[model samples]
Target chain A: MSPPESAPSIQDKLILLVEDNPDDETLTLRALSKNGIRHRIEVVRDGVEALDFLFARGAHATRVGWGMPTVTLLDLKLPRVNGLEVLRQIRADARTRNLPVVVLTSSREDEDLIQSYGLGANSYIRKPVDFVQFMDAVRQVGNYWLILNEEPPGHVP
Target chain B: MSASLIVPLALSASLVVAGLSWWNVVLHRRLRAGRDREEARCSAGPSPEEEQWRRAALEAAGQADQLRLQLRETQRELASLSYSISHDMRAPLRGIDGFSQALAEDYGDCLDATAHDYLRRVRAGATQLNLLIEDLLSLSRIVRAPYRPEEVDLSALVAAAAGELSAAEPMRQLHWDVQSGVAALGDRALLDVALRHLLVNAWKFTAGRIAARISFRVLETPGPEWPPGVPVYEVRDNGVGFDMQYAGKLFGAFQKMHVPEDFPGGRGIGLATVQRIVARHGGSVRADATPQEGAAFTFSLTSAPAGGEPPGAEVALPAGRMPVPGPGMTVPRHPTNAR
Candidate 1:
């Protein structure tokens, strides 16, 4: 069971953040950094970009020599392919079936909550309007998924 | 050829006969109206009674159509307004609050005390607007969300609200008297919201009392508006009550009677939401109070009445004397008290 020669080491934990709003993206990054998490976070602007990055298709076709992300912070409302649809495709594929996905969005609608869980989201956190609470929520999410949660074995495709 | 075929044939034949009879009644009414028209033509003009009936029917139909159109328009506007509030307005508010916070934390030493105070005010204003937006959304949700009626153990709802209120402020010495076995036929979640608001209102107003008292009990005697045997729930508290002259303004949104210095928190949307929920259940709510005495809110959820209880169940019990219904008492009796 030797490691693949071209694959990045397991010590390099990556976070895939799929968010559309730039302000929310900056705040989230700041929150994670404030919590002392130094993991390399890859930001995708929209649902379409998120899919390309995750599936290594379209603009990300030449993406190589990297392991699957440890966790994906997905936002629900997006431009082309919404977060729910992206999540569906991720679960549909065998390569990223067990990738831990946490749905972080501004929607507190019951339908969104139910549908996200129905589509196999690992966690759901509503973006609080209060900045302090938002920071706290992000802190908890980062602490749990990055440091506490045991990751599934990486599937290199 | 079998008995099943014969039974279905008989049932269908009976249904056809019933439908035909109903049509015959309709035909008879039409024929009578035509005959009356002919008689009017042969004589002078249409009778006053017939003219009045026709006008009333036309007016009712027109009013109904107008109301339906208005309702549709309101719903459309509400959907758009809720979207803008949740999606459009909240993002900017977040930015304001978040950037202000960042500036305060990262560059506090560069700013003077007055500048720090100004930033604090900006954050506070954003936070206040956020709460108002949330409350507005909640009020809209209560109006738009589907109504699901079922047997709700009101006693349990009150006690749970009381528990939460007490847990939040454990230092307060408040006496609770929640009547057990008080039930209602309504949406459980909506009923919980209404009950919590009422309980919270009582809890907030009764803060200054050394021994604050909050009680929830059902009136045994039915009011004039309620049908016989329908229970009217009352949430009473011993606190500083508002003047009855201003009671009309109490349930309106953003109508605060008490000063913020006296009773902090609450955007004054709770009672309006409570009123909306009760109206949805084909019920009504009213408030009664004296300046120094406490306030009492009585409401009736009479759309569908719960099963008939032993008449004496509404008897007021001593404080903290609740009979906690056990798991064995799980089967809640559905509404059977048909008026």
Candidate 2:
């Protein structure tokens, strides 16, 4: 049988990208761009900024018309606030509890994975070192979360 | 005429003395011949069967010596391999941890959240890898450390170990029952390591319990006793006991009775370390438990010689008048109670 038709690409979905590194951010965006994923992307430098963007706190407080992103890509290590704590807060809050939070890190440690899962991370992914591999990971994650999966309506809070 | 008769009598007496001396010589010669004959009978040439048996014994002894030499060589190789793994494996793990940390520090603003998450995981994985390497190294060191046996006040060590465990998690309610004057002859440091591992196991196992009870005591073996030697020190706990079937494998490295999710935090190296330390001291450790009941770890160590004397002495009473039996000191009335 012919390969199943690709589901209608949900290219308009928004993705909240939480990263602290410039090179990684650029690399990720380039990978997504090359994959022809036409989605609105929001970049936050650290866990604190990501929390603010999601909760409309601090700098995002004035952005009154903002909506929740379709998915959040979380890093375990970040300045001022860490990824595990952010995931904990997200899961603890009823408004964001169901929001898909993917833990993407370079850590291959079992403890991190266990802790991340314990804290209710939706998915866990390890960042590859090779440039081509990294790009492939980005594309697959983008395609899966942005196009294939369905998310709830954006929350007010 | 009378003088000439007296001279002839003296000559006859001299001839009698000479004859007695010749008889004594002949008797000595006969006794010598009899002794030689007996010796010859005893040392007669071995039978063919006996000769074959002697040759076989010699061959077996030679084979045994060769096997022993091979065993020694194998042990040496094992030690060397452990050393190399402990030392060589750490450098790469350090690089992973260090570089991950550097990456997070040097580039903080350009990446999106997803990339940052991935980097953080890398760092955590590296740190965890490093910890495992360190634990394995410590285990190897335990195996290699020279075992110097001496009198060790196990009771005091138990108390001290409990105190340290309590300090680690002050909020937990832990009850300790350690008998005083319980001593054993062992490498004090190694024994301490074993006790600490057992105590830590108790602490971790009882994390969810409302009230945790831990005990350390010395039990007297009742039977026809062997040569006076090392005494046994026991550490028991009323915690999340494991199934009895897996008790035999408890001391193996990386042998975990519970899942990581259930226990949350442990590398499962503690009991393995205890086993290594005990074995180095020429002791053996055993575990008995029922699921959800509790676990008791019993180990026998050569009791440190008393009075600074050598081992192999008869047991003696404590110097002071013996006090009435208290809780753990008394022999249990029932067989179940003994456990």
Candidate 3:
């Protein structure tokens, strides 16, 4: 049997990044770093990998200890499983039900925004095309979710 | 033998001459017949049946060509727009702006103020282009989005829009005179969008008024252009209005009547979008305004009569102050209101 879960510390705060485009991934990394966040960011290239990393299944099963990241930066357009489906699964499971998933996408469609909120995303941010605005947005998201906001209680199996 | 040959030759010559004369007569008869037919055609013009057939064929062909051209153009436009949205034309711009920022941040010590200023300009240009792209996307979406039609309470929509705008600027002394029970059969979401644009436009233009008065009510008499029994809804505001000379340009995309200094933050897309949505609903929209008095817009929605007096029963106000058709706001008198 696995050991009991414990409260995560600020120093050990991890960020799960679900992004497909290499350019966006790089920009996001730069933006986060600009916010003075030195936390480890686990980058998954697609939705399938995102789920695998979060559930500790497939390639991520043998990692040292399985714990939810402080927040998940999820991109809506992904390979295999889409962002909305990933969000649905996250909310479906008891273990990750309350995990803070922030939808980061380039879509400004009303339908996409409505669906993202409807599916229980903590926040939906449309990535600004301008770098300065993009940086500011990412900085705010990082500061708010990582430093300011309180995390929900962890699920104990 | 000589006598016999001469007699036969003479007989053959006579026979040949007779045959030639008969052929000439036949040719003359055919030419006369042709001339008569030509003259008859000239005198009578074309037969009605033949003329109709020819006209129908030409018209159908012309229409088909026009439709084909239009279809091709629409397809090309929709394809390019979808590609732009899905592949994201903004990505390249982001790359430019992001890398520029990166350069400035990483190498600030090496660059002069002039160089830094150049970077700022580049970022600003990229940001402006981003806004234009967003506006273009919205315009395209309005055209390409799937339409859903439903019964909409327009009075409620206007009241809600006004409430939101008033809440945004609670300090502004605004008076709203919105008539109740204005219902229409149309797409609720799209109609709501139109109402927002119209009301926001009114709210924006009315910024200078000490006690701004805006009204939403039915025009008692619609012009002859409108079909009978169709209710013409009017949204009027007592604010700075445009000259009637430029009224023709109001609904054009990116067309602005006012200078940026007087009124800013308008991309000039709101009215164009309103026009497109109303046109899509099979309706017509028109506007009239004086330079300083105010602007009034009257429009009719397609399909079914909307916004006449409520059939029976005093209709309850939809969670807002009842629209009093107050006389304080004197909109320019229209020609049709002579009665």
Candidate 4:
């Protein structure tokens, strides 16, 4: 099926997308383009890479003078470090503790929601099955977290 | 003449004693013969056929013992596996949910709404996985926890439960009628879980009603055959009740009277958990309801002694008195309202 229609006027914001699937990553990028949110997007395959990107550790260590992203969109399932552990780590560290974290997943379980909130997730939303609906959710999340909500200054690594 | 009579009496007595001794001897001989026969049969030693029978019996006993051990081991293994699966599966699901959330926050605007939605779906799916794990853990806990029975104030528990419910759904116009002074002997925790499930069910079912009326009270009936007084706790609610035909399966795991889509949420394990908790506490639960009118759940604690007289017949609450509230439905007086 053809992708949804594009939105006018792309917003300029830096975003780091942590996703394992290449197709999903591409779809996410395409959706963002359609929404006119043409911010610089950095993609990571898993939680470990996402952490490295956030902390400027491992391979990202060479990239000096990098600042924390405005928000962290976390997926619960990951290859190395799981989302909850990542959140715990983020919350534990004073530098990234106040960083806005949202949990996006397909799970409708109460425990997951409770845990997300318990671990200090800013918001939790379930992904829609339909492609168009999915796009709407993405747009709303982007509009709400990026343009609407005010976030703290970047954490220095 | 006297000496002759005495001599005859003594001879007769001797004769009688001799006869008795002779009979006793004969009886001893017969007993010895019977004992010999039994001993001979026992000591004859097993023939080939007898030996085979004896060996088969021993083997059957050994096999039975082995089977019993294997069954026990299997049960233990199953319990452990379920526990591990519930515990270990959460970490990965958390990772999926967390990272997707992170992705949305950081790059949501860069991506179109569709991509953001997909990520949200992934996160929701992970969250559902986590809930399934939790439900399994709850079921396991109900089975594994030790049960200790004690006197539980049903009135106080019911009042507290009602207060909590009111606090939760303050918007709803709820009428709670909980009797006072109801008490029973049961495991407090298990009973609490069961009662909570019932109250929660009541709350959910009555959601559509403009005015919800929930009652926690004890119904005293004559015990069958044994005693006059039997106390049964009843939790009644004016809500959307279920069909009578499906009532038998209401307590089965994952059994739902309504579709998941309609309910929007729930693992359908609440009633099953309640049933398990009740069974563990040696109690019985049954639901009675019509489609739209309401539902009443009644359960009895097995550990309670049968009342000697009809409830309220013997206790005689003072003039104009009434029975106490059921467990977990009490309403605490507001601090300012205290006398």
Global lDDT scores for all candidate models: 0.74, 0.64, 0.71, 0.63
- Identify the CAPRI category of the predicted complex in candidate 4: incorrect
Top candidate by TM-score: 1
Question: What is the per-residue lDDT of model 2 for residues B106-178, given as tens digits with 9 covering 90 to 100?
Answer: 6867778898899878877866665565566566556545556677888899899889889988999989999
The better-scoring model by lDDT among 2 and 4 is 2
lDDT ranking from best candidate downward: 1, 3, 2, 4
Q: Against the true structure, what is model 1's DockQ?
A: 0.61
Lowest summed lDDT window (length 10), candidate 1 chain B: B330-339
- Per-residue lDDT, model 3, residue B247, is 90
Against the true structure, what is model 2's DockQ? Answer: 0.01
lDDT of 4 by residue, B1-339 (tens): 212332233223223322322333333333334334444554465457544544443443344344334434433544555434543454455456555766777788899988988997897787676666667656655654555667789888888988998898788888999989998866688788888888988888888787789999988662353223446789999898889999998876667887776566767778877776665443457788998999999876542245432111112322322212223322221111111
Model 1 per-residue lDDT tens digits across residues A1-157: 6566655565689999998999998988988898898898889998899888888888977555467789999998888889999999999999989999999988776767899999999999988878899999988998899899999998755
The candidate that achieves the highest DockQ relative to the unseen native structure? 1
**Candidate 3 segments whose C-alpha is farther than 4 A from its true place:** A1-13, A44-71, A78-101, A110-124, A130-133, A136-157, B1-87, B109-113, B139-153, B163-167, B170-177, B209-213, B303-339
Q: Of the true contacts between chains A and B, what fraction does model 4 have? A: 0.00
DockQ metric for all predictions: 0.61, 0.01, 0.31, 0.03
Q: Can you write out model 2's per-residue Cα lDDT over A24-126, one digit (the tens) per residue? A: 6766676688788768888998989988888878998854344577889887767889899999989888878889998987564455789999999889987
The alpha-carbon deviation from the true structure for residue B230 of candidate 4, after best TM-score superposition, in angstroms, is 5.0
